[model samples]
Target: MLSTVLLRQLTDQVQELHTTAESQLQPLPLPVLNFKPTPGSWSALECLEHLNRYSRFYNAELTTALHAQPQTATPHEVGFSWLGRKSYDTVRPDNGKKHRTITHMNPAGSQLGTEALHEFLQHQKCLLEMLAAAQGTNLNRKAVRIEFFKLLKLRVGEALQFVVAHEQRHLQQALRAAHQATTAPILVV
Candidate 1:
């Protein structure tokens, strides 16, 4: 069970992230959304697609986890485990470290369309819904396992925070991709 204060804080962060991502990515044209800085880099659409994939997994997992746990009489605010805390810190945009993503989490390819943006926004909506659902649940219970390591589990609150931070990191990536796309020099074939 998470403290009301913590839940409020997390909710605020998720809302802010959703607003920023929507404002930045929702208005772009298809060409700009799909532009990659280079062959190896992700385009803005690719970034959103990658995030959407993770969001799909986490949203479902969180829903199931929330359903499985019963409400507790005395809910306390529990912090993350060491591993969970480390994982959450790693995904923050300020970390400045680029980690390699698991193959499954990577976007399929470039040439994506604005529908990716729509899906991304929908995922954000799901996240907000999940956050709202969590208010009455025991967020300190071991609810969800890490996607990469099924052996390890995180408290529900920790998992939500980690997911939000990951979203923030990728939103920053998408914004950077969009910025690069708009500024890049074009060459006629």
Candidate 2:
């Protein structure tokens, strides 16, 4: 992956994320669960929940990688596995289908609630900060072992790709959830 391309993609993702969160996430009415169609399915809120989780994880990883080798010309890299990949697909579960985080990350099992959005946004902003300060070595260097995967070696460029791609993947899912929330009908009293 190239830095210029990576920056472009990240920039796009950031802008899209801002738009999605500001425009799509907010118009949602309160009690997101109300819009949910089934017990197992995720409401639009849940999609945001998952995105928050995913973003936090990458934010930490990106910060660590950049800090660990601030002077290196090679930017550190991170990679997700096939299992992670499967869980990360852009699937917008209908209200009938449950919209839970896939198995590999479920035990992601952290706090999956409304507050997650705020936390995610903060961390994502931090990631953007680091990205801005990022320079020659940081952008180009590769990591010997991507800690998350535990056994993969990747370039810094690929790591950035993963971060943006992961967000985009979840963003799509969030959009689906939002659509469901808005279009679903309710029985008014």
Candidate 3:
């Protein structure tokens, strides 16, 4: 795909994510946001916090890498590398496969609040900025170091795709948690 087209799609996804959070997730009460569907499952806030943890790392890396590249005359068509294709495919929402989260990135038992949602929104904003900066850069260049494996790198386009897809996965998880929490019977002692 053309780099401009890919970036535009990513930009739209980010905006939709922001709107979804504000409209659907943001209005929930604290107890609802913190409610877990099952004993070991994460709550809505935990999901957002998990995304926040990743954004903290990825946003910085992407910003630095984009700044280092000189702008091109036109957007280049972007293609995924072998590793990039594998990496993003694993995280895409439709994959329906569970992967274990890294310890530090896991927010399973963290004391998260509405602030978690706020942080995620802020991260989305940063992601939008990064996407804008990515235009006219070489999307096929392996510029971003993967968070899980420091030595391995992804092309800039693939990195953006991975990040947005990851967010989509967790956002759906969070929405499910919120729905279950709101609809489930509240047992009183």
Candidate 4:
């Protein structure tokens, strides 16, 4: 994909995600945000917290990587490395298959509050800024080191795509939890 095209697409996705959070998720009450479909399932707040954890890591890494590159025109093409493709494919929101969360990334059972939602919104803003900063840099250049496997590095474009995909995956989970909370029948003792 052309570097500009890729960045533009990712930027749009981030903006839409932000809008969804504001429109559909932010106004939810605390009880609904904390509702879980099942005991083992994450609540809406927990899902956002999980995304917050990841954003803390990735936003910083992206900043460092973008700063290291000299300013230049956007590259003609943003090619995905094999590892990059696999990483992004695994997290695409439509994948539907469940993947185990890494231990540290799991936010299950945490006493998350409304601030989790606020933090996620802030993170999305940071991501939008990073994407804008990335436009003049070469997307194919290896920039960000993978969070889990630090030895492996992803191209700037790859890292951006993976982050956005991962966010989308969790955001959908959060939305579902919120919907269930709002629609589920109340129990009376």
Clash number for each model: 1, 8, 0, 0
Q: What tens-digit string does per-residue lDDT give for candidate 3 at 1-189?
A: 998899999999999999999999999999999999998899999999999988998999899889988887386778999999999999999999999999999898888889999999999999998888777788888889999899999988899999999999999999999999888777967
Per residue, candidate 1 scores C-alpha lDDT tens digits across 1-189 of 446777778788878877877787788888888887888889888888888888888888898998887655245766778888898999988899999989988884845777878888788788778777766787777878888898888888889888888988888888998998887668867
Which tens-of-lDDT digit does each residue in 69-97 have in candidate 2?
Answer: 74645433434445334433423222234
TM-score of each prediction: 0.90, 0.68, 0.96, 0.96
Each model's lDDT comes to 0.81, 0.57, 0.92, 0.92
The 10-residue segment with the lowest total lDDT in model 2: 87-96
CA deviation > 4 Å runs, candidate 3: 186-189
Name the better of 2 and 3 by TM-score: 3
Candidate 2 accuracy as lDDT: 0.57
Q: Candidate 1, which segments miss by more than 4 Å at Cα?
A: 73-75, 108-110, 184-189
**After TM-score superposition, what is the CA distance of residue 5 in candidate 3 from its true location, in Å?**
0.6
Clashing pairs in 1: 1-140
Please provide, for model 4 over 54-101, each residue's C-alpha lDDT reduced to its tens digit, 9 standing for 90 to 100.
999999999999999897864687789999999999999999989899
Task: Give the poorly placed runs of model 2, Cα more than 4 Å off.
Answer: 37-39, 70-104, 107-113, 138-140, 144-148, 185-189
lDDT of 4: 0.92
